[model samples]
Target: MLDRRRLLGLAAALTLGACATGPSIHADYDRSVDFSSFHTFSLASDTPQPGAPPLTWQRVSDAINRTLQARGFTRSDTPDFAVGFTLGKRDRIETWNYGPYYAGWGQWGGGPWGPSQTQVRTITEGTLTIDVFDAKTRRPVWSGTATQRLSGPVSQAEIDAAVTSVLAKFPPGSTQ
Candidate 1:
């Protein structure tokens, strides 16, 4: 016996909960490569995208540096592995259908099924891909990708969270 307003509010809340669970992270590394030998890293020179904001790139780089340093990897001019990352964003459309809500039996059809509701919204999704390559051989050793729904302009806090979530699996085996 819920009103239309309350039912719609509940549906919106459920949708938000599903969307706000943070970034989806995935990581992979070469099995033959001994990640333990990688003790130092240097940031690769990356050309910013033609129309992208500079601060977003910088924020990601800073977050990578902080995360790696905390994991006991040092920055060096001549390094074991080189780190690089790319950022991308795209618009996504999400649709949710909330089926009938009961409001007590009254009409000839016994409550009229409350009328099915469909909600649609457009969201921006951002993705960050971080790659680690062996400086000597120039072969990739480890890579992580994080994807999340973004809210307008990207913020440093969001960048940090995404970077941290992605790199938490770096080196493959050890707890980070």
Candidate 2:
């Protein structure tokens, strides 16, 4: 059970959480100083929709690739690294029907009411995951995930923002 007043206060806070950024990259530069060093890169996604939006997929993917390239990750036959993401919605009932009370003229009715308090909740969630591996060893070296709200049918700009925010936490020089 949650406190009524407290929950109301947290509504805005949770909404803002959707805008929260991803992790941070503080490790040394990865072993792969250049894109070629890793092998190849590909994006693996299970995004809610199939068809890409106007400039949304292209823009977001390109930006993600660029970010990886800048970080020294390369592109190849079998990408040594893979990028994946997901988006979804969850119902959150912010408010509900409370007692029909007047605070007068009622013996059994606590507040002269007829009904009790009831509410439903709805929320949306989005997630991004990045996987890095060693081509030679055929093993994943590291991976990261960032989850938040869709807020809406996110635009290309929004996707970029989300991806950028998440990748910003990639570890530096992650490879051994």
Best by the TM-score measure: 1
Instruction: For residues 1-176, write the lDDT of model 2, one tens digit per residue.
Output: 34643343233223213344542322222454343444467765435233223244455567678777776667555776566533222344466666656334465635554556677766544444555555556455555555565354444555566566556656543442
Error of 2 at 149 (Å): 1.6
Candidate 1 local lDDT, 1-176, one digit each (tens): 34754443332222212235688889988899988889999998655444444555666788899999998999999999999987666667999877665433565556555787889999866677899999999999889988776554455666667788888889898787
For each candidate, what is the lDDT? 0.74, 0.50
Pairs that collide in candidate 1 are: none
User: Counting only residues 3 or more apart in sequence or on different chains, how many pairs clash (N, Cα, C under 3 Å) in candidate 1?
Assistant: 0
Q: What are the root-mean-square deviations of the candidates from the true structure over C-alphas? A: 10.5, 11.5
TM-score of each: 0.75, 0.50
**Which portions of model 1 miss their true places by more than 4 Å?**
1-19, 96-116
In model 2, what lDDT does residue 50 have?
38
Which consecutive 10 residues in model 2 have the weakest lDDT in total?
A: 8-17
After TM-score superposition, what is the CA distance of residue 166 in candidate 1 from its true location, in Å?
1.3
